[model samples]
Target chain A: MVAQIVFIIILLGAVYLFGKNVAKVRRNILLGRDTDRSDRPAERWAIMTKVALGQTKMVKRPIAAVMHFFIYVGFVIINLEVLEIMIDGIFGSHRIFSKPLGSLYGLLIGGFEVLALLVLVSCVVFLARRNILKLKRFSGTEMTAWPKSDANYILTIEILLMTAFLTMNAADYKLQLLHFGHYATAGSFPISGFIAPLLPSGPGALAGIERGCWWFHIIGILAFLNYLPYSKHFHILLAFPNVYYSNLKPKGEFTDMASVTNEVKAMLDPSFVPEPAEVSRFGVKDVTDLTWKNLMEAYTCTECGRCTSVCPANITGKLLSPRKIMMDTRDRLVEVGNNIDKHGKDYTDDKTLLDNYITREELWACTTCNACTEACPVNINPLEIITEMRRYVVMEESQAPASLNNMFGNMENNGAPWKYSQADRLNWAASDKVD
Target chain B: MEQKIPTMAEMAAEGNEPEILFWVGCAGSFDERAQKITRNICKILHHVGISYAVLGTEESCTGDPAKRAGNEFLFQMQAMVNIEVLNGYNIKKIVTGCPHCFNTIRNEYPGLGGTYEVIHHTQLIQGLIDEGKLKAEGGESFKGRKITFHDPCYLGRGNNVYEAPRAALEILDTELVEMKRCKSNGLCCGAGGAQMFKEPEKGNKDINDERMLDVIETGASVIASGCPFCMTMLTDGVKHMEKEQEIKVLDIAEITVRANGL
Candidate 1:
């Protein structure tokens, strides 16, 4: 009766927290204005195929890709095992799978244990690659605060979970041995088989150990579930749908400019044209400026730094780093969310928050090359955000690059960038021998 | 019927409801050789009994360069004005020798409420050949001389018409070699996006220079392109690298006109 009450309370608590966390993320995703360009069918297919199934961006780094694939697959397969563990904890029987299916469940648990070991080893390599090896790709790259510590904890939890599985398997193996008074299925649990000879031979003590191992496995899983929202492992839950609905537009396709009159009519009008008194303006200054999808992208960033590695600007000693952009956005969102929770919507001034978080030069430095967008493993389109900021800078404030100002002046007056007479447009063609 | 071969001026004068409007873009109106190619296209159209009208000086820049430079308002203004002018004449279809103009009028103009059925001169000429309205006289066969075709971005990827120019060259019996990155992935010729008018950005080498090197690597003696801007850029690249003798740049229209002995 005590176990049942504990199980129900823990299960309800986890479900509520999980739903709340995911709901907060969904709300954040919806807050941003619609910015997708889904005009072309081919473009949509290309994005879906490349980002969803191909996993092209992740494959750029083979070692990381292999490690991530195993972890991803293992996490998916192990969910059923988790449910079975919970049911077994509550009812004192692994009734989720019967006889032959139980044997298959055992095999699956064994396979997942091996995969979890591989994931732990791979994550160590990833750590060394980030910290000790200090790969140039990761140098000065922005990472989530406590990334190293979080990674270590996540890895430890995963290792502990696998260890619990093995311990429970070994205790079962010992019970089976003692029950039959022999070891016919000794080879079935190869790793656990060795533990039988070492364990005490009495049935009573072995049964006690079995109960203890069951508690360890169940508690370990529950603890891991509760810890997921606060760890980099959150991506494990978020990346699937993020990859599924990845933007599939052509590289240069921009969001349609809002119709001026419609935008005006939506605002309070004092003159012939209505100027929106509360226009959000272009460019993300803070978390609220980011669409809910952008917020989701920030949360889903695995801090892998693949985007920074391939950025041409970063390669050429530029101040812009795409990884930093995601990290910054994520940090700002958390800050704003905390403030809002504590003091409601009017807790902090939006302009002050934006000015402090995003810099003008950082916005201007982007080349709109689509390199960062192409490099992002999670399919985050940073270029679209940067371009929107650029549009705002150019249209609302009339602020642009000095060179562009001169060029725009020439285009307005001479109908070309050359500042020459419009008649001279064909001078280059005149010099060419057409026949 | 001994149909008259119209000069650009004569074509502009006919003023009838032509089945097609020949867009004598800025290049063809002022450039000598482009004008010659325009005249040849007119002659071909006459032989084929296809009535076409020429929009002479009335045609202006399609504002492609302006739009690419982030001058969206000016581009939209120019596009709106051009749409009004074209709509006034009920000009629903257009053929142009310039790929820049072809791409602008067909692709970009529609964003500002202008839409027209636009085709490049090569596409139209290829259509003429397909219908048996035009025939090629057997030339020196272009057999031994290795040749390659440069896919101009505006005509190829920007508009997604890759096969027509190659189809035209193949009919001329030329050995057509393709560069490593051709078609949609074709390298820019250090032109387009208004880069032709502005100073080239700071890079170790020009994109056109890089593209020309790719062409030379194919061991082609002649580089054929459809766009006049690409033609000039490639020609200049060849001359700058002193590969003038090794490679020649010719517009596919000029090449087709030669193959037809016009």
Candidate 2:
């Protein structure tokens, strides 16, 4: 009774805390401006299945894709074992499903054991890639200590949790072999059977070790669940919706500003009268000005740096890293969310996502090549945020670079970006240089 | 020879209408080097006997650079004015030499109520060759010369027209090569997103210089280009590397014209 009550308290506490964090994240994402992504249900479903569920995009880098496949599949299949553990924890029963499931229980547990071993091996390889190989994508200017540590910590925790699960199974198998109390010979331990011999033979010592491992495994999983919203690992949950809501149009099309359209209409025609304008800002000044889809995209970034690796500006040693852009957006958004929690919802912060986090140099360095968008496994569009900030810089403040200003002026006056008159528009046709 | 290229106004006034409208973009009109590409496109169109007319003085910038540079007001203004002129003529199909113009009119203009069938000149060339209107006959045989196609970001990834441009080259007898990054994974020639109008931000090397390394790796003697901005950047990159004598950066249309002896 005492053990079951303690398990119940811990389980409830973890659930409540995880629920609170998820709500906070949802609220923070909703803090941005509203835009509809509800259209094209059929297409969105197909894309979600292909990109998120099928992991099609992840296969672009075949080696990483194969390694990730093991971890992803293992995590999902092992969760079934977790369901059994949760039931066992609540009712203080040892392999309760064993009686009803009979022979099938052994097959299920045997499969999970094999997967646990694969997951363990994959984690070690991932750790070595980050620490020993020191891949360039993992060490960008924005990666700093915390982002690096976050990645390492998650991998380390998974290793510890997988260890606990296998050790618990091995101890249980040993107890069952001796036909100890309440320890039925139920599970077929293909992997744990090998480790059972390494354990001590005393029944009392084996029981204690099994109990300790069980508690540690379940508790570790609960802790990892809560850590997700705070870490880049949130993509495990957010990738589905993010890929589904990604821009469906051709990559070249930029969203037109409806407010700009109204203003231009009034200026062009004397008879045209526009509607009374609302308090509309030209473009994004902060997280609040961005669309909810854009904010969700920030939360979904995996920090994998695939986008950064393929980015033209970043590849050429420029200050613009698409991964860093997503990181900054997420950071600034969390700060804004915290500010709202401390103060009122309408409270203003002294800092913005513009000069305070992302600088003008980084924004201007982009070529808008859409490489980052194409490279993203989750279909996150960093170029959209970059262009939005550029709009705030130029349309709101009229502070575009001098060269761009010249090009704009030339387009307005000369019917082109150059200083030639429109009369010469047809001059190329008469030229004899047919090279 | 002074080519008699008829404007839409001239053709319309003569009680005749063209089957297609050739959008001679700003770079094609003003830039001295890009004009060579314009002439090559015209030679192919004229030789194929495709009835096309230019917009002439009525044509304006499609506002791609302005929108990309974050001046949406200027971009929309340019788009609206151009749409009106295009709508007035009841243009059903259009072709452009520049991907920037092609992208703006085909994709962005429709949202503002201007819609038409827009295609890049390379796609037009591919169609002409596919329909048996053009052929690689009597020109310099590039049988053994090494050539590679640089996928302009706007034309390749932006619009997903990779096969058309490659098809135009496949019909030639040249040993066509590919850069390390080509098609959807193509690297920019460092001239996109209004970066052409401004100096790049402080970096370890210029984007074109880095891209030139990819071009050099293919060991291609001739670099096939499509977009005007890419042509300028690649031509400059060849000069910067002092490989101007060994490598020639020619537009795809220019190559098609040479291949067909147009």
Off by over 4 Å in 2: A431-435
Judge candidate 2 at residue A183 and give its lDDT.
94
Whole-model alpha-carbon lDDT for candidate 1:
0.65
lDDT of 2 by residue, B1-262 (tens): 2578879999889988899999989999889989888888888888888899999889999999998888899999999999999999999999999999999999999988899999999999889888998788878677888999999989988989898888888888888889989888899998999999999998888888888899899999999989999999999999999999999998899888788777
Q: Write the per-residue lDDT of candidate 1 for residues A147-195, one digit (tens) a residue.
A: 6577667766776666666666677677676564332242146665655
The numbered model that scores best in TM-score is 2
lDDT (0 to 1) per candidate: 0.65, 0.91
What DockQ does each listed candidate score?
0.12, 0.75
**DockQ, 0 to 1 scale, candidate 1:** 0.12
Encode model 2's per-residue lDDT on A1-435: one tens digit a residue.
899999999999999999999999999999988888999999999999999988998888898898898999999999988998899999999888889998999999999999999999999999999999999889899999999999999999999999898999999999998999989889899998888999999999999999999999999999999999999999999999999997999999999888898888888887888787667688877988999999999999989999999988998889999999999999999999999999978899799999999999999999999999988989999999999999999999999999999999899899898889988887777646444
Native-vs-model 2 lDDT? 0.91
